[model samples]
Target: MVKGEVCSEGLGPCDDTCNSKCTSKYPNGKGSCDSISNSCKCFYQCLQPKPEICNVGIGTCSTACNDQCCNGNCAAKFPGAYEGHGVCYNVGPSIYNYCVCIFKC
Candidate 1:
């Protein structure tokens, strides 16, 4: 049920400021929060691609995944669900227009 933009587990880098919740994952100056936006502030090196605003239908589809898939996109493949495994696929704009969840197994 996790929706919206998926955050990357990987931080910008040791040279960049990271999120407050995740600063301990990096060194001192490598992670901090911007008081205004209250978001992780990073040095220029941590710059990454912004999440894309896609549509449903053509870009629309649906899939489910485990914790591993929660943070990013996983290529479509498989015999579908295995055992208690969840599905992992793209969804539509109504439900979503991006990877909804990530998988671990």
Candidate 2:
């Protein structure tokens, strides 16, 4: 679950108006008005797992080679995992020299 705050308008005390605004914004979320901040605190379930990163450090390779390496490393690190992939990035003065694995947490 995640908690987020949204600004509330009007010069009156915090009331059900904040709840209505939050509910309209996030139908699946619950909200409450905070008197201290005059904002709406919303709590909702996370829709997706956060992405995990694995840096393979500096390396020299082509896009295809980097993709293969990242995929292999990510697979080794997260075996039997579903819904994950790898990406190749350039770093420093060299281009296409970094491997990063982005996978589901």
**The candidate that achieves the highest lDDT relative to the unseen native structure:** 2
lDDT (10s digit) by residue, model 1, range 1-56: 11232223434333333555364543332345544334564322222243222211
Query: Would you give me the overall lDDT of model 2?
Result: 0.49
| TM-scores for candidates 1 onward, in order | 0.22, 0.34
Clashes of 2: 0
| Candidate 2 global TM-score | 0.34
What C-alpha lDDT values do all the predictions have? 0.33, 0.49
Q: What are the runs in model 2 whose C-alpha is more than 4 Å off?
A: 1-65, 82-84
What is the lDDT for 85 in model 1? Answer: 22
- Candidate with best TM-score: 2
The C-alpha RMSD of each candidate to the native structure, in angstroms, is: 12.5, 13.6
